[model samples]
Target: MTAARPGSREPGDQEQPGGGAGAAGAPRVPAPRGGRAPGPAAPGPGTVPAVRRGTAPRQRTGRERTGGRPGAAPGPEGDGRLTHQELMSLLGVWALDACSVQEAACVEAHLNDCARCADEALRLRDAVTLLGPPRSLDLDPQLRHGVLESALARRPAVRPVPGWAAPYDAEAARLDALLHDINADEWDIPVRVRWFAGEERAGRSLTVAQVLDHLVAMDGLLARAVGLPDPLGADAPADPLERTETRWRLVTAAGGDSGPARLVAARAWEEWREQSRELVRTAARRGGRTGEEMLPVSVCDPGIFPGLGAAAGPRIPLSDAYLNRAFACWTHAGDIADAVDYPYEAPLGAHLRLLVDLTARRLPGSIAGRRRAGLATTRARLTTAGAPGRTVHLEIEGAGGGDYWIPLDSPTAAVTRVAARDAVAQVALADVEFCRLAAGRQSPAEAAVAGQGDQAAISDVLSALTALSRL
Candidate 1:
């Protein structure tokens, strides 16, 4: 959907619901120490037992015999009582500290039915187990000592660029070049109609025209932040006839047809292209780092900007800005490409993967503690389509002897295999969807289910990711 134009009235700014950077009542949890826990063992033969709260494990008719190993606790007995799944969740927290193989198996069986529990179990496993091998690196001791001493000696000053800030200059240039290549004839339509009128995909609704508007506004803001004269009129008269009148002066500078809104939109497009090119040139000459490195970078609360303002922050690291902006551009470009019936061509997926890995490795201790419990490994088949004709035999293993095989390269379609652990939670959604959810625009449940093959696993991953994001 098209974003409201700059300077337009917005909804009352409210903190995003649920906890994260800008959420209300978010808790401060400790960082996780290592990697994730192991997978769960597979349930062998017959119908897997269905466990629910208030149902006694023993008293139910047609219940399978609990062939639990020796020294195993008796399964719950009675209606409306804790079922195998509930008990596993309870034990999942403690699995890292100590849990028997049989206990893990029982929990895995329960997880097959409960998505939430499965997700939790996977998180706990990551926290307690998945420690990567320690790396040994050689460094100059004197340099290290000097850097530390310098850090301790003085507080670093946050400085603004002497001229216009040049954050994202390269990207801006690329965008300008791309816009120039598109037919000038096509620029004369409403951005929404041009980009998203008939698109039917999750991320494709925001059209290129909408994206242009956003970029123009953003560039203006960035320029203002660095003490540059606003290239587009900062105080132009609002045009009553414009679709979005807040930035009317700037929009009007770009000529369009007199009667039809389409003509206005086309003129706006041309203006945006020219202004964007100028901004990129100005940005390139300015000696500034990425937006993230700009200390005290001001951002409004997402409550003010609908989907855009939730994760605002000041002087965020350059890496973070690059990640956020890259994701935004890439995902939206994917949408535009889809709308235009073109192949998607973006390289941000690798960067996204890196972000996930970093976030996973640095989860807080409280969240990590949860993952440590009852961790096991299992093998399952994985498949992906990006790679051509290559099949990878993935070994999935976890706490309860959970093992399966996956064709890592051809995982476009979900394939069912014998798995006690919810594979989807452990691998896919947990690492990515959680961050997006915390940033707003998605429900925890929705993120959990995104691209998930195993609902139970997705739930577990969601819980862990939610917990981690809060931390």
Candidate 2:
């Protein structure tokens, strides 16, 4: 840990010297115990930087300071100031060059204003630098070939992400990058997947390979719906769930011999990626499918989990279908990361904003059906949820985000601008958290909703959003 610079000690830690009147008749107090000499008087301006005296550096909040938790209100300084904890938490990541642009900026800004933080960041950076590169070791020629094969096996056919789908695409690409160096043995590491059913956490567990197999199965449906070739052979079942389970069995069984199994998984994954690339390219060629080109695209029955698109679900534009596919790819990538114990970062800003926008548009109607079936006074329940007010302010922060006023009374809420004061509830969520909540992968109880104003109205909106999708 970095030591504080001279004069940066807390007031309590500074020696308060006391001394009897000296021969010159100057009054002074004696020095405090601990054999410390009297501290020097504050330096004149320009001689030394001013020490910011006051409260003990704010106690660390939670495990580490973040740029504020997803929904916690920002300090009066807004998001510019990094708390001590925030700076500390960011130090290691920044040193490793693994931090996002926003996070890096926060640390840099905090370092400028805080000598303690700056010193600490320097110490950490130096330690990292001293570690240097790993000692070189001769590798077996066969081992090198296997590693290269594994890395290439994970590479999907690359393509430029369309403007609206950039975040989703970038996130998927990140997951692909994560698999590059994983050991063969780590492929089977399993992770528990959970979702809130009312208040209980429930969902299946999956291994890295199994999760990729599932993506291969699910995205195959998206590919077909968007008029791309089926990644799996024609023998697969028509029902997506049945097909998924059936293909999962085949893919997993084929890999019974680990070497052969990896090849099987790799082939399926590559085909899916290639088809995904084609799907996007096709959509782009059609001028991105605006207006009339944006038509209802029902691919399969709604009963099947991650059926990809619903037969009876509302008709969405063609661009949304691609975005939805991207969401699926990126989300499962998160699952793979959890299994392998790698840190996963989702794309932020515009890409994530698009998904948030999609969820906001669907919120009202998703609740309307349940409202009619469950409540005797449907109008009252709807009003309590603030649907009558017609709009809720969603403050989705970090990456692919903006202040959105989502309409609560209709199934399709066009992107309308509404003032902060006019919203029924000002709900705040991080980009990934909101996407997970909207996708039905996370329930409200499982997700924290940071908000101001009508608590009931916020709860109402969240409850309606709890299970918007089955996958």
Candidate 3:
């Protein structure tokens, strides 16, 4: 260092008490606390920092603490300068709050002096935000508005959905609401698609996104049947499961399955949503609106959209199809919920009632078919609408509960005698439980709660309900 000339102060020299005098000896006013203060004499050794009474001691800047060199920061090895590499290495540990007291002080002190390290530390902090543990299944706050907007856009909120399409509209919306709550990675989490197969509970494991793909593909079949565009083109299989495989393969070929899983799943989700809208719209339209329903498209599997498990059935009316698919939607939503360990509830009571009514209506057909297949013992006697000779009273007991007499002879009848006296056997089930049975979650043939009168007749009815269930 160059020697200072006599009577000339250095850049870092401090004013000391009773030392230098100004011209005419006028006293200088001291700066207030929290502002600049006079420093003690340059220390030879072991000098303690001075503390001002009644005021907090001033904190030294990184530069001042490191001997007044600009951009220098405090170091771990007391009084020694920290190398740029050493400071750079501590950034991540500091961001994570894992640094030791001295080490942290060193990194923090250096951060302000290095702009590159400062920027990197900021990015590290931003990454830390995603690592926080999740505590609830509460959906993103923005999801509610988006769903509401979509609903209002489809039709005025004040207009009641037609009864035939109401059940489907409600169920599809419920399932979509549930989907909104899933995390991005949860889309690929494994879930089992279950149904009663013959005498056992049969299940197939599928990722959450695959389930959406299945729903989309199947709903597309229904849309195509109603003159809406087919998502998988004209040659897609009419079988629900088969068409689902084709949809997945197309997604793979189009590179949808190879991208970030959330993006791929999102595409499938949008398609399913749009397919649902088209189906619902078709169900709502009448002869005045368009002649779209004139195009005949045959779809197999009564579990087509909502039932999703039946194979090779005659084409049903669009309204009835929506109700059937709606029930299946609820069942499959349950499947997805179970896979992700999320809580789900049965459909609204009125909606549940529609499912029960539809299931009851379809039961006669199921029994007739099963009898043909030799799975049912009931003797088939073909009869027209309202000509019921032998009938079982299906008395659903809870939410959406009512009495209905199912014809033993004819499956195509529009109405049958619901009289109590004509009933040979009566079966009662909770609305939710009955729907679950119909969804193939449990074997109806071995049901412990089959109600009243003839045991053989009750078993046939229960088995018929299970037969309607598919994935």
List clash counts for every candidate, in order: 72, 13, 7
Deviation from native of the Cα of residue 256 in model 3, angstroms: 2.3
Best by lDDT: 3
Cand. 1 Cα-lDDT: 0.35
Q: Give the alpha carbon lDDT tens digit for every residue of 1-471 in model 3.
A: 011112221112342322223334233211112222455443222111112222333233223354423334445665656678988886666555555444545555555345466567666644554554544463433354467569879876553356667667777877788889887778878788878776567889986677888888877766777778898998777777788889889888988887676777788788888889777777666422232122222453743222212342334555556666787778888898887788777666666776777677677777666776778776666665444456777777787767667655545443333433657788887777788888887666444465888777887888878877777
Could you give candidate 2's per-residue lDDT for residues 311-393 as a string of tens digits?
Answer: 23445555656666666776776666666766666554455666666555456554454454452122432333222345567
Ranking by lDDT: 3, 2, 1
Which candidate tops TM-score? 3
The candidate with the higher lDDT, 1 or 2, is 2
Q: What is the lDDT of candidate 3?
A: 0.63
lDDT of candidate model 2 versus the reference: 0.53
lDDT of 1 by residue, 1-471 (tens): 111112221001211111123123222221112222232342223212222122212221222334444423345652323465557655443334333434434444444455455455556644433342433221222343366449756864243221122223333433444454445454432232221111111222333555556545544544454455554456622221132334444444644234454444455567666665554454444434443354333321111112111233224343433333333333333333344443433232333443333233222221223334432122232434232221111121221111122222122222333221323333334433434443332555464343435444344333433442210
